[model samples]
Target: MTMIAVCALWGMLFSVLLAEPVQAADLIRALMFQEAQRVLITSGRGLVRQFPDGAEQVMTTPVVVTQLDGGMTLNGARAASDMVKVRGRDDDLIITVAETPVSDQPQDRLSDKVSDAAGSAVPPAELGPPPMGALRGPAPLHTLVLAGAVQVIRRGKSLMVINEVDLEEYVKGVVPSEMSSGWHLEALKAQAVAARTYALYQRMMNAGRDYDVVAGVQDQVYRGRRGVDERVQQAVEATRGVVLMHQNAPVFAAFSSTAAGPTEDAINVWSKDLPYLKGVECPFDANSPYYRWRAELSLQDLENNLRRQGIAVGTIASVTPFSFSRAGRVGRLRILHSEGELILRGTDFRRVVGYTAVRSTQFEVQSVGRTIVLAGRGSGHAVGLCQWGAKELAELGYSFAVILTYYFPGTEFNNTRFGAQAPSSTP
Candidate 1:
């Protein structure tokens, strides 16, 4: 049969999963409005509060928000003058300079009335990052581009600026950051669903915490309304509330750039062997740039890595692969030294040897004098969906649902429940 016929066949395997249906379009507002559907994204340093008039605020007396040499840091005033950093006793956010409060609240002064009647709801057109793209001056002077509103709070001594936004809106920002918008629509849809699921999982995990998820690599990259493509927005809306589930719980839905040969089991990377995260072949990923790679590290550099991992043995002697995972990745390895030997899991070794340099756990180690060579396949922990593989599949005429099931087997799809507050377990 043709690829389209095969896609249709695969699609038939998944019918509506729930007897009581829930619309994907309204899933966020219906199930998670109580939870606020707000993802707490960590704002980077030097986040200028850009107003409708183009005014910027980088600091507030005691609150010194600077790049700090291109790092995320917000401490007391720097050496701009004679201001000293003061540590407050209580754990609330305070914009204070030395001892006095320095409040720089955003000004909301609109000449026109927001509504025809007081206490009436603001129309849908009026809801967005306040006057960001709105024309300000007489000359149609400057169009202000910005992320959504930022909520600044203190996490201990430092101020944490969070971008609190609706969960579906948050997915639109993530799809572009995680996958290129120029790729196939199905692949973008897969990314959207995965990101949405991951966000909900994080929400459930951090429900009572200060933030649900961060806007960094640690969670998912989110830049509010900035850089999001229209195609990306369409993909997010298409998937809507759909999420991967295993035993009625929202699967962690881990994903990576490429899986050179086959995806890995969760136990290999995170040490958690969930039901849905089993090894699966991904032959299409050979089209990825990271399909095959090699890294050469000096023996001394390897020794430095050992020391950084708190292992001391002077110099290295030999390296050996102790064990392998089911997906053909190194599960355990031995580092022989002149004094003794150190045992390490493949993921831990990759961390110590430099994640970028080592690239992946699937590699062969060979020593050529003072240099140690590592030849590997793939980039990132090959756990769930292989993005490049998905793109290739989509290009080959597979639907998003078919693509998702190909990567993650045994998970059913339905707009109902949509994986929010997923039942503790489902078969």
Candidate 2:
């Protein structure tokens, strides 16, 4: 059979599998690094290195892994194999990858190489560090102190770092990174369930892929044990294995920082038109720092960014909102350039301009001179749950279950066999 046939077969199989309940003991494979040039791996307690041939060795010192012409070099020694696994010895399996510099290749070239190696077209931006969130921007050094086994796989001339962690532990790491740990406990609990469900959903969908989710804004921001604290632990434990279920399968459980006005429909953003992901009245997050914002974008820079992304365009003349979604956000935009008229999706425009610059599609073009001025509200795609709205609900004495149901209407809690059992119903 051809590749498409195989993918179709797997999709059918996973659709059947989705009906089955997920287990709390399930392991989550998260991608940490894509096309990294080099990485230093070590364990706080000693290191147990497992070779591809099933042989294991214990090393007390740090191991520098670099992509070699054939495979990889471990501490300057040639390892003919394409993969290696590292784990902590006699400890909680905390593996640390220190000072790993990302690939110096240009974004498009790196993405092409990865897509060729992985047998799929991966987005250029995803092959690098996250564009937004706590890990956004360039850093001189990147360190990941992760819990669980770490796999270093050589693909082409680069390496991909993957973390295999327990489901609950992964959720624990996500809770604080996606939302502030200082928020109310109820809000934290809601976030935990959402994060867990999203991970599980992605895992189920991408069972044939190398990893389930990316540890960044692409999925959920997961910093391993970095932001995990007492409150975060309590929240994860309280809602352990609880996920929002629609028709026996876990919903996508998408959430964003703020839903400045009303929560958005997933169809409008991701084209996934699930009943539970419909827009709803959400005026509770007005106090969000991103609830209101202004941005100025030079048309020249916009044209340059678009061309860099392989979009053919000429000098821009004007940009106007062509259509709006049900939530009153721009759905499509008309870009009048010197060459011709180019219409782009509002979401795609945000990606081209930069997520931080154009926070959301819910903005109006104030002016279109040499530069574009935008006044908008909210941050993120505005689908499913609103983090700020959850915070306000929790502060108003609402239970986590209530908060979830309010945002994701028609979804109920289903507990996988892990962590503490949730309450019988929303209080």
Candidate 3:
């Protein structure tokens, strides 16, 4: 059969498997690499490349994609075009990149990178570190097995790699990447639903953009088919096409590692008040490793980080909690510096200091000598569902439905086909 005929047949088969009519929104465009200069892509079972002008070709060897002056180069040969789409013939697409080495010096430990809107920085327990790199320097190659078609689009001087995959398959990639598959079956189910809802919500919000969600901590960690196991598959299938709905639309459905104390209010964290994201007493996550931890950073380093973010500060003299939220998490901080004083929001403070360093805003600050010591509870921003809390609840025999309702109060379950519309107000 021709490629067009085969693609039409596959579409019909996919719709039949779904047991529902497929729509344009049923697919998720996940941003895998943004503005990357180079990437290595191949497939074990042959590959198919589609051009912008509706042409296709089959390849059996690996292809290196690099940005050019105007267009791009395929294996050092110019393609004369700015965009290309590639997919595996019958196997998963493998993307490879060289890994950057981590610095060993203590002074170089501070990372200026900031977390996304959700402020989730905790790594998945089962899937160690994500296969994350844009390939800047030469090093050991790290391979990522992805189950979707990748679009390589060149914008100006750099190239972007986006994975366009089925919504259900996207959720499967997210479940094991966010939470461990070995956890209670109920917790995994809850995570599956949340991941699905969050993805749909993002798709709705980003309809005007090129992609829906990013495959990283910025959005939800999606490692394609890397960590998917039987349990993860079961969890996804059990709650297939289900999402948390609020007023006939999917909620933001934010989640985090641990809410050591009470879950936070979205109004306090992101300044967007959703009726379902109210704070609630959460005492089930004490077993979490990040429940209570201490992070110390030198005053000089803090000042440097603050300056890097365009916050003018001469030398940090003292850092004190200026205000507290209703959940008792720090709301703002008063920094005394050589120049003067600056009031920084707790969320901005977490951004200035690495998310991994400060962990959460529910912390006590102590300026001892030349270092600032922070004793904090919780991981992530403490908004919406708490994964560790859900684990404990699942262990205590709570059903996934009950766990989801407990975290996202006043939210109802709805099929993705019906309730995946954009809300009247963006969260």
User: All models: lDDT?
Assistant: 0.57, 0.75, 0.76
Sort by lDDT, best first: 3, 2, 1
Q: Considering only N, C-alpha and C atoms within 3 Å, which residue pairs clash in candidate 3? A: none
User: Who wins the TM-score comparison?
Assistant: 3
Model 2 per-residue lDDT tens digits across residues 159-184: 88888888999999887666767788
| Per-prediction TM-score to the true structure, in the order listed | 0.66, 0.82, 0.83
Question: Cα lDDT for residue 29, model 3?
Answer: 93
| Candidate 3 CA-lDDT value | 0.76
Cα-based lDDT at residue 12, candidate 3: 65
What is the clash count for each candidate, in the order shown? 4, 0, 0
Which of candidates 1 and 2 reaches a greater lDDT? Answer: 2
How many Å off is the CA of 277 in candidate 3?
Answer: 1.3
Which predicted model would earn the best lDDT?
3
- Residue-wise lDDT of candidate 1 within 380-413, one digit each (tens)? 7788887877878878777777777666777755
